[model samples]
Target: MADLLHSVYVADKGLIFKVSGYSQNLHLVVDLVTREMRAASGRVDRHMFEAVREVRARSYHNVLLKPHKLSQDVRMNVLIEPYISVRDKVSLIQNITLEELQDFTDRFLDKLYLQILMQGNIAWTDAIKISENVLKNIKWEGLPEAESPVIKVHQLPLGDRKLRVMSLNPASTNSIVTNYYQGEVATVNDTATLEVLMMLMEEPVFDVLRTKEQLGYSVFNLVRYTFGVNGFTITVNTQRDKFTVSHVDRRVESFLKKFSKDMNRLSDKGLAAVKQSLIQLKHTTDYELKEEANRNWREITSCEYKFQRLLIEAEAIDKVKMSDIRKWVADHFAVGNKSRFRKLSIQVVGHLPNSADNATQGESGVQDHSLQLLHAGQPSTNIQENQEEFITSIDDFKKSLPLVNTPRVELAQC
Candidate 1:
């Protein structure tokens, strides 16, 4: 009796097929996977209904209500993979029948570019045999490597940018403000510098925004790597009852100002200490095989394939001087530096008292009435008409910008 755990997932680029269990079950798993991949049958309606409900449920999730995911969705769909819908349409899902689903699978399986990442106790010959067995039954024309799509992000035009969306959950009072400072496409050195910068600012950011100013209980910074574009985000989770989204946004700006000064005043010794701290972090041992495998998977999926990324980054971190940090700040994060500075501020406004005059009182008021204006191409109260700073329509704004193709990393770099 051969039994194995298996999963199929859709990613930004392609579908991933995974299976794990005893080595003895490898052939059995492959046979099962190939059979499933060739076609889909039975209970299609039930699966579609579940998927629709899943999407609906996700819309109301607390995490989705925050600016982190909201901003990410815009960045991915509008600025990155413009062709892909950030959210699947429930209407489309409802209309998709068993025949359509099967047809889609047939079309999908017709062309292929399979990337296998085999690990664990499996023998090399067994891995190769398993891969061969999986592919033998599936009729596919090998896709040219050049024809494979490379994920690209639209280069944001210089100046301040903003996208303000009313939270979908009207009863929720949790508003979020995220200030993202876009960096370059990034080299190994650039990646190292930004990581170090985040490490240094992480604690201070939380302290200044949440602890000192009492903006909100949750405040932190993140190094965002969308496809291959590198950037950083400073986020504050505040309630509408305590503070307005704009107030929190301003406080984040203030924190950045103070942080810039702090960075400049940072002594050479202090900078070295920060670098050393980051180096130590990179050197930290992977506690499990999964940890190591996941790290490799990230590089593989990102098309960077830098298995020695930690070691390379550690070296780069040591080389990053105070001047390099200052240059990075001026180029990306500085308020006055508008030429190369790309900043996008995304605000998710939650239910508030008098945030807008038309806002209804009580839990019933949780409706996203402003979304009507969004669909109508009318600027909401938060955005002014003809304001270049505010992104009235994500599609239009993205269309105005040029997409930059991220260069794939060669194995030589590894």
Candidate 2:
């Protein structure tokens, strides 16, 4: 345990250091994180350029070829802050000076609020001692205390907004399309319900889109909760040679339309089966010691102190009436309820010339065809006329239609 107190430093923007170990080794973990944080605050300029350059290189690769990164960019653009590209991020890091790095560390520390969570085989007294010692060693004395940074998530306007981004790497044929359905601010119950909904939707979505429809190799339904905002996203990663981004989007919408009806027609026995499966899953003690520690850390960092959130959600699942599920589906996915539900479509298209209209706008001076598609009402000149024609022809071929209401289903009375 004495040797375990070796310092670890992370040069990320939000957190300078994080230490996790078994609860029995709490003293060592606390000393390690505290020592690292203090050392980081004092040595901000040490290896700063190398650290930034390495991270920047990694980020650039992540943005170019990573499908998840593309999906995340769209989700963040619609639900929170617009995402800065890896290129932009790298450029920003390159311009930052050593003094700027030091200043950032100083300011960040001045306003830092330490959150600590101790669970499993640890006494409350020892936890308190650990906390006190960590704070004492961090040397936060005489510094102006700062509140945690307020997370202000952006609200999506009612109706649909489609954004098409061209991948910077033109050589890659893989394209990603993500549709985000924005809903109300998240509550514990709502989050739990959505989790179950995600579980229910995941397999079917994969089976239909990936297996049956052969839309893509990777297809998923993800429940996204950022700060207080909550939503679900359906994404497909496919190639332009096989299907256009617009074609993939339509297929996803088609699946949702069919899924709504299926949800309504779900028999009582079937619904109960799903619920039971989720409950059993929640009750399953499958997590290792390290996984449990990480879960606790996640809850603490997110300021969601419901350490037993899984159990709480399992209980909530039992209380979920079929009507609740139906209503939620109707509210979020049922078309024509545009006021209550907002959907954002993001397409990361590939470089096939046939599908060039949907090709992502490059950082360099490549003409962006989707610009006209997004701004359909704007007039165009001869040069712009050719671009508009290219976009409209693709739009017509794709049968770009407005979202229509899903036919209401009649469920048997419970």
Candidate 3:
């Protein structure tokens, strides 16, 4: 049983059941899984407490990582996903009985919208046979296509907002600051522009933030699409001993200000070179069948169904003008354009004597084109008490902000 059962895991999106063995043992593995799913015995096992402790430890470690902690906060507050924090999980699990667990599992499995992906040397007919056996054993009602649950992300409000939370690891001296620039509704063209911008900013950002400025060892950027609503983020993991979270946040803004200027100096030939490189990257061949299958499965899961996204994006990149990139930066990031842009800043401040500075004191820094370049990352060491700009209550802040109503992806007509 141990050899045949690979693992069972759960994430924010969904649960996954995995098994592995020889092709001859495939039926046996499926049968074992089906029986387990069908049996909902409301019997408590004392031995399972050890496993619970392990899970709790892992969750604790996950939240301890500043970046992961910041991401969880953003999803819960900005995206409005009801995520269970590590502390909450511990309390909930302690009070939960086996009967409650069994009831919850039964209710969860009562109706299902199953998505299966089969790879390797399995034939189509054999795959269908395996799927049928599992479905028959489960004996669950399939959810209607229209009624299937879709992941929804709340639209961030226009203008700048900041969420500053103390870091989970009190012993650790490192802090993380992430500034997310939310774009308009998701489109292939806009996504392509973001990809190009991030790529261009990648080397320069590392050079300026980590190498030259010495902010932190880990400084990077990401292109994020929450439930297909486009956005991008720039993050810095700096130590509170050297600088406060407020200072790091300001420096991040300062980098964007400098990067914006660099974009204007960019010539047509330079932009073309970057575009061509991106095109070549898109056309790169998959190393194996698994890679291709995983790519397609991602599309299926997201409901994007854009299997040829890479090629489509490549074409869009070819059409992208230097003006498009410049305008995108200016529209979303330029100072004095607060009414037009929507920005969310998440700061996970570490526990240290110097780390307790006001997270929202540097609103004026965004407009300052020239500052002490050497000492700019260092905010006044004097700890401020008042921080009205910081989002103290997430619920109150979100009450007035409008949600982004992104249109659903329609299935292609046959």
Instruction: List all candidate RMSDs to the true structure.
Output: 4.2, 8.9, 7.8
lDDT of 2 by residue, 1-414 (tens): 433322344421245344445556758766766667546645655486668666765565556455557556545534443234444554455566767766776565555556565656788998898888877776664433344343355555556666666554556778788888877777767776777777779899999999999998889989887666678899899986788777787788889888888888988787778888989988988557657766776666665555697898899888777777777788787453444666777777665644544445466632222221333222211222112322233233224433222222122311
If both were scored by lDDT, which would come out higher, candidate 2 or candidate 3? 3
lDDT of each: 0.73, 0.64, 0.72
lDDT, residue 246, model 1: 67
After superposing all C-alphas onto the true structure, candidate 3 shows an RMSD in angstroms of 7.8
Judging by TM-score, tell me the better candidate of 2 and 3. 3
Candidate 1, after superposition: displacement of residue 166 in Å? 0.7
The parts of candidate 1 lying over 4 Å away from their true place are 1-4, 42-68, 145-147, 353-386, 410-414
Give the lDDT ranking, best first.
Answer: 1, 3, 2
Q: What ordering of candidates by TM-score runs from best to worst?
A: 1, 3, 2
lDDT of 2 at 390: 26
lDDT per residue for candidate 1 within 74-186, as digits (tens), equals 55555675455434442244455557666778778888888788888889998898878778878688978797867778888876787777665545677778887887787
> lDDT per residue, candidate 3, 1-414, as tens digits?
445445667755567665655566776777677768857444447567446655765565555444456455544555654444544554455466666777878877888877777766778899899999888888889877776766566677777777776655545677788888888788989988988899889999999999999999889999988777788888888887787777777788888889989998999998899999999999999998757877877887776788888899999999988888988887888453554587777777665653443233343412111111112122345544235456666667667667677777666731
In terms of lDDT, the best-performing candidate is: 1
Best prediction by TM-score: 1
Q: After TM-score superposition, what is the CA distance of residue 386 in candidate 3 from its true location, in Å?
A: 8.6
lDDT of 1: 0.73
lDDT of 3 at 307: 82
- For each candidate, how many residue pairs have backbone atoms clashing (under 3 Å)? 1, 3, 0
Q: RMSD in Å for candidate 2, one decimal?
A: 8.9
